[model samples]
Structure formats: C-alpha cells, structure tokens
Target: MRFFNTEGPNRADDHYSLPPLSRWDLDAILTLIEQKKYFLLHAPRQTGKTTCLLALMDYLNREGRYRAVYANLEGAQAYRENVDAAMAVIVTDIAASARVWLGDTDAPVLAREVLATTPHGSALSLFLAHWCQRIPQPMVLLLDEVDALVGDTLISLLRQLRAGYPQRPDAFPQALILCGVRDLRDYRIHASSEQAPITGGSAFNIKAKSLRLGDFDAEEVATLLHEHTAETGQAFTPEALARVWELTQGQPWLVNALAYEACFEQPEGRDRAQPIGVDLIDRAKETLILNRVTHLDQLTHKLREPRVRRIIEPMLGGTALGEAFEEDREYLVDLGLLRRDGAGGLVIANPIYREVLPRALASGPQDSLPQISPTWLNPDGSLNPDRLLDAFLAFWRQHGEPLLASAPYHEIAPHLVLMAFLHRVINGGGRLERAYAIGRGRMDLCLRDGAVTLGLALKVWRDGRPDPLTEGLTQLDAYLAGLGLDRGWLVIFDRRARQPPIEARTSSHETLSPAGRCIQVVRA
Candidate 1:
C-alpha cells in the first residue's frame, strides 16, 4: 500500500508523490546541461531536491547522451576539516552511486586508485578527472547535500570542482549540479588555513545559475491527496483539502506529514470508509506542532543563530526591518523560514511555521510555570471568555514577570508568556491561530473552542511611544469584525524603562470600539 513519505527521497512506486520534474523549469535546466554549464539546485531540506535530481539523472541517461550519476555528499560531513578523509568518502560514494545507477564499475575502480595517489587538496579534482576520462559517455554529475561538509572539507570540495571546470567532457564531468538547502552565495566557510571566511561564490565561481525546486502548487497538492482517495475510497472533504493547503502553503513535508497523521496515525481515521474532515486536519496540525517533530525542531534550532535571531526578533516585535537586515532576510527566505508576501513584506513562510515559531519560543516559558486549575473552563468544559480574561489577569499579576524572563526571544517575551498561558487554557479542547508581520506594530490571535471564539490584538508600549490604546482598540475592532465576534481583548504591554511594577499596573477596562464592538482593554 502506498503511504505519504516523510523520510528521504520519495519513490513513486511506494509513496504518493507529485511528479518530481514538474516542480522545476525542466526546459531551462536541460538547456544548461546541454550547454555543459555547471549550476545549482537548492531548496529547504525534505523538499524533494534529491528526488528531482535523481529523476533528472535517469532522464539524462535514458536519452543515451550522457553517463549520469547522482551522489549524496552528506557522508563526507563526518570528516569535517580532514579534507583528504572527506574526499575519499565522497569519491567512494560517487563510485557506489555510479555502479548502482549507471552499471559502471570501471569508473569506481579507477577513482579509488586515482584518489589513493592524489594529495589532500587536489584529490577530488584528480579523482573526477580520471573517472570522467575513462567513461564511455560525457559525464553528468549531480552532487546532493553539497553544502553539508563544513570548514576545510567544504572549501576543498568547491575549490576542486572550480579547478576542474576548465577541463570538460574528456577530463572532468561535462555538467555538474550541486544541491543543498541554501544557495552557494549564502555559504560562509571558515577554513583552518585562511584568516578570513571564504564565501561559496568565491570558491565556486563557475556556477551558471541557481535553480530552486518549489513546493507543490495548489493543483499539485490536490492531485497528491486525490491519489489516496482514488486508491482507498476514503475521501477528503473539500474543506479538508482547502484547510491542508491553507495550513501548509504547499510545503512538501508539512503537506505529507499532516495528511499522514490525519489519515494513517489517528485511530478514528483508520477506518477506510470514513472521510477525512477539516477538524481531523486541524488535529493533525496541532499534533505535529506539539510533538516538535524532526523537521520543525530543526527549524526551531536555527533560532539560536545570531543571524536568524536578528530577522526573527524584529518580525515578532512588528518593528520595521533595517537596511542591515536585508541580507539576513534573504538568507531566511533561502532557508524557507520566511518569504515575501504579495506586497513584498516579509512574513513567516507559511501558516504552520507562523504557528510553530511563537509556540517553540514559548515552550521555555511554558515549562517554568506552576500548576494551576483551568479556572476559565465551565462545568461542561466550554471556554468562558470573560472568565478566561479574569484568569489571565490573575496569572499575569502573580507569575507573568518570571515567565517573561524565561522566554527565548526577549523582545517578544510578554507576548510569548501570554501565549503560553493561553495555550495551557486551551490545550486539549481548542485551537489558537496567530498572525503577526514586520512593521505591523501588533500581533493578532484568534482562539476557537466549540461555539466560543475570541479575538485578541496585542500591542507593546515602547519608549517614546504614546499609549497604544486608541490604535489597539481600532485594530481589535477590525479583528473582532473579521472573527464575527462582538467582543475581544486589546492587550497593551508596557515595556518602557521606568514603568511601575506589573502587579501594580496590570489592570483591565471595558470600552466600545469605533465599530462599537465591546473591547476589554488590558494594560500589563
């Protein structure tokens, strides 16, 4: 039976997948290869880069024009700065791939001998030179995870590839495709022998173009889900299909993971006759976020890097990004953590990431809180918005300061702490949706539980800024109108240097918005 694949490269025979080559401009890529131009293929991890490269290799070999091989260079990462050791592993892997995919044993045999005799720095170029010379057809090499090797190993590989570019067809591969999570221009390698960092562009100046493998389009996403319905007769409701696309924004791993969880992992969904619904998809999204699965966890880990933090901090704070933040913004876009919205403003890459970022940031603060009763939940377990507000006020008065200190993104600590408390309130029975963006000056949240839906707008009062109450109320009015609720909360966190203590200043007042929606204004 075919299933959604979340692991390595997807095999069409075993996994439900979109056509790999369909995600790229195949004509352009083929033109590059035909011209013998070395180029790059890059995308975030688990986005089908390997699958596409393997498909291209197969297509090239079947055309009877080139001897094509795809090799994963990740194995060389273990050797780190040991260039010679790394080159040996890389050469061996390339040979193994050639034998498996191209039925070429002679190339590996020759490569092993050549590598044995070559020096550390020039070993890769020498081995490739010998192997290509022996091949019957012009060689097309696809090196996957090319950026996985760090330090001297990475510099050596790129430099060697560049050095061999002048000798083509007969002495070196006719066309080389390097694949990794980021473009070559973004790579910063610190070689032990060099005093300064070497940019990948400097090391590999021969790159013709960098082609990115995009996520599935809406039509492609529908086609993948339909495969399951066609096979098992267990259909996804139209709403479920739309929800999946909205949540994932066509991110490959997220689309597959959410579907797999909803249709395969959930016990209720195991009955083949049952249709998958929007609620089930929502549950699956929550499950993935709460578990911090490998893919999402890997992204969260990047938040610690200073470059990553610079972009993320301003984003969460809703402040304007400075000119200096441009490079970092581009870097995050390449990593698939952020993307340009239609208006060209920066936003989280997708809804799932938008949800994951704050939740992951709040995890530390959430862990430090003391056990408290779900005071806002009614006897029948329905959420009471007014009671919830009262409970939050009490919680903030007593414990909010310490929890804020515990948050990882200090610029948005108050927001994170509030979210952590609200998450605890709605843990089992409800869902929370967050929306924030660069220069928005506020964060909007919507909480849903059964028939109760609450809208909230959060603003921070920073130095030299007036109290944001009037603006916040206007925003909350618009937010409540969108949520179809007549009442909502506008939380203004006072973050100025000489503010009174939180316990003494935190208070709430009720007011009417310009739209006349009842607004509960909370000052913390």
Candidate 2:
C-alpha cells in the first residue's frame, strides 16, 4: 500500500508522491544544460532536493543525450578541510552511484586510477575529464549537498568545478548542477589553508543561474492528500484538508508527516472507515511539535544560532528590525523559518512554524517553572479565566524575576515567561494562540480551553517609553473584538530603570476600553 513519505527521497511505488521535476522550472533547467552551463538548485533541507535531482538525472539519461549521474556529497563533510580525503570520498560516491544506477562497469576502476594520479586541488576536474573521455554521451553531473563541504574542502570542490568549466562536452561534464540547502553563493568557507574566508562566488564564478526549489502550491497539496484517499478509501474532510494546507503551507515533509500521523500513526486515525477531520489534523500537528520530530527539531535548533536570532528576535518582541538585520532576511527565508508575504513583508513561514517558534522559545522557561496547583481548572475541568489570572499573578510575583534568565531570547523573555506559565496551565487540555509581527508593538494571545477563550495582548514598557497602559487596553480591545469577546487581559511588562520589584509594584486593575469592554490590566 502506498503511504505518505516522511523520510529520505520519495519512491513512486511505495509512497503517494508528486513528480519531483514539476516543482521547478523544467524548461529553464533543460536550457541551462543544453547551453553547457553550471548552476545551483537549492532549497531548505528535507524538501525533496534529492528526489528532484534523481528525477532530473533519470530524465536526462533516458533522453539519451547525456550520461547523467547524481551523487550526494554529505558523507564527505566528515573530512572537513582535508581536500584530498574529501575529494576521494566524492569521487568514490559518484563513481559508485554511476556503476550501481547506470550499470557502468568502468567508473569505479577509472576512479581509483584517477585518485592515484590527481592532486588535492585539481582531483575532481581531472577525474571528470578522464570519465568524460570514456563515455559516448555528454555527462550531466548532479552533485547533491554541495554546501555540506566546508573550508578548504568546499573551496577545492568549487575551484575544481570552475577549472573544468572550459572543458565541457568533450573533456568535462556538459552540465553540472549543485544542489544543497542554501544557494552556492551563500557559502562563506573559512579556508584554514588560505588563512581567510573564501566566498563561494569567488571560487565558482562560472555558475550560470541559481534556481530555488519551492514548497508545493495549494493544488499540489490537495493532490497528495487525495492520493491517500484513492489508495486506502479513507478520506480527509474539507476542513481537514484546508487545515493541513494552513498549518504546513505545503512544506513537503510537514505535509507528509501530518498526513502520515493522522492516517497511520494515531490509533483512532488508523480506522479507514472513519474520515479524518480538522480535529485530527490539529492533533497531528501538536504531536509533531511536542514530540520534537526530526524535521521540526532540526529547523528549530537553528533558532539558537546568532544569525538566525538577529533576524527572528525582533519579530517576536514586536519591535522594528534594525536596518542591519535586513541582511539576514534571505538567509532566514532559505532556512524555511520565514517567508515573504504578498506585500513583501517577512512573516513566519506558516501556521505550524508560528506555533513552534514560540513553543520552542517557551520550552526553557516552561521547564524551569515550579510546581503550582491547577487553580485555573474548574471542578468540571473547564478553564476559569479569573483563577488563571490569579495563578499567573502569584507565580510571577515569586518566580518571574529569576525565570526571566531562563528564556533563550532576552528581548522576548517576558513574553516567553508569560507563555511558559500559561503553557503549564494549558498542557493538560487547551491551546495558546499568539500573533505578533515586526514593529507591531504588541503581541495578542488567545487561550482556549473547553468552551472558554481568554484573549490577551502583551506589551512592554522599555527604557524611554511611556507606561503603555492606555495602548495596551486599546490593543486588547481590538484583539478581543476579533475573538468576539467582551473582556480580556492586557499585560504590560515594565522594563524601565528604577522600577519597583515584582513583590512591590506588580498589580492588576479593572479598566474600560474605548469600546466599553471590561479589561483587566496587569502591570509588572
């Protein structure tokens, strides 16, 4: 039976799949190859790059114009700056792939002879030169994980590819495509041998164009989900289908993982007689995040990087990104954490990422939280908003100061801590929904449990800013109106110098918004 593929490359017979080549500009790829150009095809990791390269190789070979081979260079990453060692591994991997997939008996033996003769810097160029001599058709080399090579190793590989650029069709490969998580130009290798950083552009100046592989569009996403229905006779409801698209925004691994979880992993979802619904999709998403599935974990792990932080921190804190932070926008987009909106503004890539980022940031403080009674839970188990606020007030009065240090990003520490506290309350049975954007000056949250949805808007009183009490109330009013609520919470974290300690000045008072909604204002 065909199932959603969550790991490695997709297999047509085993997995409900899409044609990999359909995800890119096919005509452009063919044109580049026909013109004997070297280029880059990059996308975020685990987004079917290997699948695409393999499909392209098959297409080229079947057309009988090019003897195409695809090799993943990730294994060579272990050698770091050792150019000879890295090059040997690269040659061996490529030659083995050609032998196994293309049924070529000469590549392996020829590779050994070349390795014995070529030096560190020129080995790949010389190897390709020799291999092209033996093949009748022009060679099209698809090198995957090109960015995995580091330092002098990466430099050497790029230089060698560039060195072979002039010898195409007859001596060198006719067309070479480098595939990786980021574009080749973004690679800034710290060359130990050169005692300086070598930019990828300088090393491989012959690159014709860089084409990025994008996530599946809405229709493609539906095509994949419906494939499961066709195979198993278990269908996804319309809302479930839309939910999946909303949550994943057509990210390949996420789409597959969510569907796989709902259709196969969860016991209730395993019953083919019962159709999947929005609730099941939500559960699958929560499981993927809470369980720290490899794809989400790997992407979130990048959140700790300083470069990533420089781009993401401002968005979380609701402050304008500094002019300098603009440089890392493309990098973050390449990482798949953020995407450009229709208006060209940067936003978290999708709903799933939106939830995961805050949840990930709140994890540290959540773990640090001390034991507290579930005063927020009613006798029947529904959430009690007043009691929930009381619990937060007491917890913050006692532990808020120290727990701030536990937050991973300092600019968003208060937001994280408050979220951490609420997460502890809701972990039993609820959801915390959040919305904050760059330069928005406030973060809106909706806490849902059973039939109750408690709305909130969080603001900060920084060094030179005013008390923010009025602004907080107005923002909370708008947020509550959106949620169709009459009242909610407005939390203003005071960060100015000479502010009173939590024990001394933390307080909550009732106020009315301009719209006359009752707002409970909390200042700490």
Q: For each candidate, what TM-score against the reference?
A: 0.97, 0.97
> What's the distance in Å from true for residue 247, model 1?
0.7
lDDT of each: 0.88, 0.88
Model 2 is weakest, by summed lDDT over 10 consecutive residues, at 192-201
TM-score of 1: 0.97
Q: Note the residue pairs that clash in candidate 2.
A: none
lDDT of 1 at 451: 89
lDDT by residue for model 2 over 1-524, one digit each (tens)? 98999999999999999988899889989999999998898899888999999999889988998999999899999998888899899989989999987999899998898889877567778888999988999999999998887887888888888788888989999999999888646456666455355563588778888888999998999999999999989999999999999999999999999999999998889999999999999999989988999998988899988878987888988888887355478888887888999999999999899999989999999999999999988898888888888888898999999999999999889999999999888884889998988888988899898899999999989997778888777778888989999999989898888988976778898889989999989987
